[model samples]
Target chain A: MPAASAIKVMVVDDQTSMRAMIRRALQDLGFKDIRDKPGAVEALPAVKTDRVHLIISDYNMPDMDGLQFLEAVRADPVIGKTVFIMLTGSADREVVQKAAALGVNNYVVKPFAPAALKEKIERVFGELT
Target chain B: MMRRIPIVQGEHAVVAEPGVIISTLLGSCVAVCLQDPVARVGGMNHFLLGEPTEGLGDRVGQERYGVHAMELLINRMMQQGAARNRLRAHLYGGANIIAGLGAIGSSNAAFARRFMETEGIAVGRCELGGTKARKVEFMPYEGRVRSSVVADAPPPVLNIKPLTPPDDGDVELF
Candidate 1:
């Protein structure tokens, strides 16, 4: 488990503006340490350093979408156990089913509230405590 | 009255409310809506990608993709007392979505246009193609959509695209 003082988070999404807004939202929620990426391909190595505690990724992306990102994380035992959440504008059944199948902690739709995202993170952390 | 019909990604529904609207948005994906004025019912769908995944939602043997998404929207309208002949269609989105993301959006738009032409559904309104990101608000009752640019995330001209797969392959994290 990562120390509370150093809560490293990595957010991945194809939409750059959305990613920035989400980063600001996390900061507004008092999450001091945050990192953002455009998609899975840009976030992979950044997560391997063993310092990241959570990953917030979008489901649909080029090269590899969200499911591929989850599968990629799963393939590597090192990053397999990290907390995962999916954020997207879509409320598709496939999105829900795939996240369920992959054991994601939460699934959030677009135009979502920062509080809801933070609540899910808190819930995940609370379970660890 | 507007009803909350859960139109799944590839499924669409027709409602009976005058004020309610049927809408869907796409970048690389596409949303197709069809309405029958005489029957006064219609439906819409949000399809991702041009090709159907392997064995995706097949009962016996049905490859549901762009074409399937459109068909489902039409079928749902028929279910809601819409006639087959009076159906009119409209399409929205299919923006480049994001660059370096492949040609999924362009292909999706192409497929949607072809599907409507072949189905004999008179295509009325269509706003598609571009480099901007968009959101589609669909109203089954109104048989129309309001497409808006919610957040424009223009690709970073220099070093914009990410450079990794998952938890490896460079691209500084911190």
Candidate 2:
């Protein structure tokens, strides 16, 4: 398990309120190296230029939706294997299957609490310290 | 008197006359009313969720619940003699009525806008993103929309106590 403060995480969502809410939850979980982007358009470039260990992104966005962003990331040789967690408004089975097929690490539906966020992260990083 | 049709989540209606009014109630759900004045054809869809992704395999199926409600609306509009390039849009809903549900309303609204922009549709008037539930009535042929807030009192904030994840056999770890 990695230290929560050590993991560099990137959160991508188009909504300001959603971004702030997720940022607060990450802070509550002791995650210090958190960065947020309004949408995949900005996030894609940031992930390519910087070192982001984990990505938390919303599924729906302008310019480029989260699934397209995920495909772009997975196709990159350098960032192909990075841990990805998708955020969606509902828990539809087809969306789940699609994300899983795209090599996403995990997912969370909207209205999740900090505890729920932490649980999804732990499932990927195996319990953050 | 105009024919009144009320649609709920995941439903759409298309008409090509002046005697029908399509309506819906929205709370975090979006209704996109599209019309082509030249053809005098129009339709509306009330979508619960999902954004459009082009060229993806079974793209429509993989969207929100195996259906992209926006596409359904657009397709129905085209079928009723509305041209894709001439489509004008009026968007409504996507309200964050419940505080604890996160910004699902914003997501739905953003998706609707983005879909229209990507498809080259022009949005004329819109009412989106607030903390109140709304009642929307649309006269498709006239491309006119009348909206009123039916509920505006903010929901009680959730008192979330941190505890172990629920093990009610409903949590799927994927």
Candidate 3:
């Protein structure tokens, strides 16, 4: 696994505040190369060209929510294997089961503290320094 | 007389004495009412989602999540002489007020239920998952709750009469 500084993370959310919040949390975890997109429509193109190592996206949005975005990422041949973590305000069983079926690596609910974010990332990539 | 404290989203309150009512209006949001009858202490919390993370952030911004809210309510109840093993829960809200949108109400209700089950809390009087918004009033000490569908209820009337327009050059009133 790559070091935290080596990982390129992309955050997708419609709300500007939410995107900033996630970015700030990632930076606190030692991630330096982070990019943010307003929604999945814009994020898809950026993800293809930027080669982000991780994708953190919100579950609800005006166009193409997190589940749809995950589907698109999985279907794409180039970045299909990139790690994906969903950010959702709703942690219902059905949504979690669906995301699992779509191959989502993990998900974090809203209002999460910085440590929780670190733990989720660690689960995917092992312990982070 | 009972004192009422209206709690909005991401807020909670605990009471061990009588004459206090915690109330909230809900639409696609869930509120959990917890009580330990033996200790005569309990509280209620309103939340949007279940455990997104294992622990809560230090800031008040973390209060909206179910996991955090639940933990806070339980800890507070215990502080007031409640026991975890004797905790009983009542759930309300999680109504889908509008169509075409996703089932947010269903999701919220499901999360509340799952959280309680995971924590080994026995739930009673669970009123969740419907198309109508609800108004809930809970008396924590007595372990009693009242809920009503307010989706079509009339808005509260204000006592102030309509303001009169002044004969000003620029100012106008409606």
- The sequence of per-residue lDDT tens digits that candidate 3 reaches over residues B3-61 is 99877776789999998999988777788989999998988887766333432353323
Q: Per model, state how many residue pairs clash.
A: 13, 0, 0
lDDT of each: 0.62, 0.75, 0.76
lDDT of 3 at B147: 93
What DockQ do the predictions score, one after another? 0.02, 0.04, 0.04
What residue runs in model 2 are displaced by over 4 Å at the alpha carbon? B1-173
- lDDT tens per residue, model 1, B1-174: 564443334445567567666544345556776777776676677666433333224221121245334544554565577765677877876778676777766776886787666555688888767767566666655665567875567322322121111221121111
RMSD of 1: 17.6
lDDT of 2 by residue, B1-174 (tens): 989988777667998899899988878778888889999898888776633332224222223321245645665676677767788989888898877878878987887787777567899988999989888899888878889998786422233222221232244656
Q: How high is the TM-score of chain A in each model?
A: 0.87, 0.96, 0.96
Off-target runs (Cα >4 Å) in candidate 3 are A1-129, B50-64, B153-174
Candidate 1 iRMS, in Å?
A: 16.4
Sorted by lDDT, highest first, which candidate order results? Answer: 3, 2, 1
> Taking the tens digit of each residue's C-alpha lDDT, what string does model 2 give over A43-83?
98899999699999988665687889999999999999889
lDDT of 1: 0.62
Local error of candidate 2 at B86, Å?
Answer: 15
Q: Candidate 2: what lDDT?
A: 0.75
